[model samples]
Target: MKRILSAALTLPLLAAVGACGAYGSSAQPSGPQPRAAAATASAGALPTAPGSVTIGSADFPESELLAHLYADAMKARGVRTEIHADIGERAVSMAALKEGSIGAIPEYTGDLLAYLSSASTARTPQDIYARLRQAAGAQGLTVTAYAPAQDADTVTVTRATADTYHLSSIGDLKTVAHRLAFGAPAPTRTLPYGLPGLKSAYGVTFRQFVPLAPTGTITQNALRNNTVDAADIFSTDPFIPRYKLVSLKDPKHIFAAQNIVPLFRRDVLTQPMADACDAVSAKLTTTALAELDSQVANGASPDAVATTWLTATGLAH
Candidate 1:
């Protein structure tokens, strides 16, 4: 969806958390292990199954595609694996990993940073990945090299509203603030990147704020039907393009960079596994991501879409 957050909005996400604790210490995975990583610890080590891994993904079409990609990539490495698609939000998914329910989960670098530490300054993708990897390590998780694709946060308005108000940036909404109603995830109303930044960066506040529908469809429909003037939408949402909505530029960078990364439990990042994941990250890209998303949005079965993509991209035989 969206890529890098401009420097301005990036601050809030960073400011919300402080320095992440050191990651060398990680939460150990649950269950029996094939081999012990060290002399005395049975936990926090990869299973000795040698060539098998489990990957988890969050809810949403893009995530499903990613899960497929990861599963396919690992399969190519001669690794047996399971794909746990739609594992809910980050917190829940991370919990799944921490509990050893799944070996690895895709995460956003900025999100992990915000979760680990609250500094808001702009950091290039490379830096973000390194930091996440290090922080994840502390929790007994490892952030594998990040992928090229980034589904950053986006604030969007109806195409009609944008044209009518000449609202081009988050700043422009200030003048017409009273006339607009914004809808976002329930948390955005109070979160750092939520209303506070709108007040701080744009000097504007909405006449009303509504809860984003539990599923994105409701929010998307609300925006289309004019039930809401604006709403939070991911940069790559197929509906954005399909509906011809106007994606307000986040010149202030309120949303953080959310590059896709695999967050692995200690058991999954053995050197060979890490290298296999890196290959997937290197090949994945925004354009490719958009295409995979479109397949599901267009109504193809997820498995069929994932299968086609894997073969076409040569990620799977």
Candidate 2:
């Protein structure tokens, strides 16, 4: 559910890749780094010092909810924790982590991988997590176990549109695509899994391309009003069900796996701290995430939603 800001959209993918690579190469000033030294501690091991940690989240509600889940669970295990939500996007949040402003943040595996290494070829959850761990390590970060829940980029259309066009999958759009308009964030037009990949992978080409905001508002309105026949929506967006939209299946795996995971400053993670976060991942499921998103979309507080889920799952008493 991360949105690439319009300013970033101006850069070509290759240029952005180079910029990310350069940022990764810059050395961080030595100070009190996260406790990555305790990484060898076995899963479920207690942290040497349980009472000192800060949890960070991105600008979105789901990320905030995830942050709460981690923070609450760690607190349950006697880890001193603080939540810093709405801390901006990955770049800003990651900077905060490295500078010791935050100990950990909720992250999506595929996106993290792409940010760390744009040339990454990892696609499935396991492969993406493996590459993400290695890449994060190089940048002085530690990645915890990934949850089954994912919020991936999806090509979706109104149920009416799907029925009319007999579109059940991305491949089915090949024949009717030329007659339809497509909508998504501006950068999606060039991202490897966006417009270019759609045509190359499925031989589907739209009559027109519309650039819309990633908030789901613009794209949803465009699709609902018939201004655009289809749009790129997040897989976990509650509006999809509210509007009865059909998310076309991507048998060709056009988008990379984006399982939710914890990315933290290596120096801050202790064996017990890692285990506490991993326990959350072990119980989190796609259905649960969708329901939580729906509740938040319906006006529930992110912290409330997260707490309810954690309690229900026995992660919090």
Candidate 3:
């Protein structure tokens, strides 16, 4: 049987576990965090263990759904699994993993690598994963095969705004940006990959900066009402299609790659378990992820959404 443990119930249990060491200083990069490759064998494939497994997720819908996917699939393969959903940010969740409160969690490649090594210059998926494996290994964790699905921080505008400015990519925005008001999370106004990187990488300088919620109706409404010309939105946000918004391409890789992958503790991962998780990765795509997210946003439970996908892909019975 699978169980979804509440934070209140789980935090006390995890309090006795020692820290995995600080991920980094609190002055970490302020990038969008709530956010793969073809199916391949896991890097450190080991045999299935007879013991139970504990899975966890960060405090986000998509991540919670993924935790269910992993737990249900593992259970199908005869591993007893339970989920600790909404465990807070990556740092908090990672601490739980290190202390044995949980064994696995879904994670993004580039951001995880960045958290591990702030100085990492990895841009491509392969480069980022390689660096991530090394960094994660140091923390007693392992990154399994990555899914083809990817999500990134994107500069988005209404279709009308794109048409009016003849914008097809971030670079094109440079020409008309000076006349437009840009909106995004308040921290993005100064983050290295936010306004600063936008200016340096694409020569984009908006007429004014409009602070708005990162991914919600507030930002969408702002764009729809023309209060801001463009906003920083996640690629996986379903609102992009529903509102007919256009996401400007980032050829310069300003936001970096964020392919989905499972990050788990080394002791609990076996070859069979690794392969089972990889099967899920093989079937997930960016389009599929967005659609699933749409369902969750519309009030569907993450567990139900995940079970449907797993059954459809023949990963669960």
- Specify the highest-TM-score model's number: 3
TM-score of 3: 0.83
State the lDDT of candidate 1 residue by residue for 1-317, as single tens digits.
Answer: 12122121120111111111011001111132112123114344444444666788776556666777777777776777898876676677778888888898767677778777667454445556556655666788766666656566556777788889997777888899788888876767887777887798778799999886334466678888888887776555555556776666665566665667777777556655665567777666644665566666667766787778767777677
Tell how far residue 147 is off in model 2, in angstroms: 1.0
Against the true structure, whose lDDT is highest? 2
Model 1 segments more than 4 A misplaced: 1-50, 58-62, 85-101, 117-127, 270-272, 297-299
lDDT, candidates in the order shown? 0.62, 0.72, 0.70
Q: What tens digits encode model 2's per-residue C-alpha lDDT throughout 1-317?
A: 24464123211110111000001111111232122233323223444777578899887677888899988998888888999988887889878988999999988777889989989897766677667777887788777777766677678889899999898788899999999999887888898888898899999999999987666666678889999998877666666666787778776667776777888777777666777788897777655676687787677888899889899999898
- TM-score, every prediction: 0.71, 0.82, 0.83
Candidate 3 pairs with clashing backbones: 36-147, 36-148, 36-149, 37-147, 46-270, 46-271, 47-271
TM-score of 2: 0.82
Ranking of predictions according to lDDT: 2, 3, 1
Task: Score candidate 1 by lDDT.
Answer: 0.62
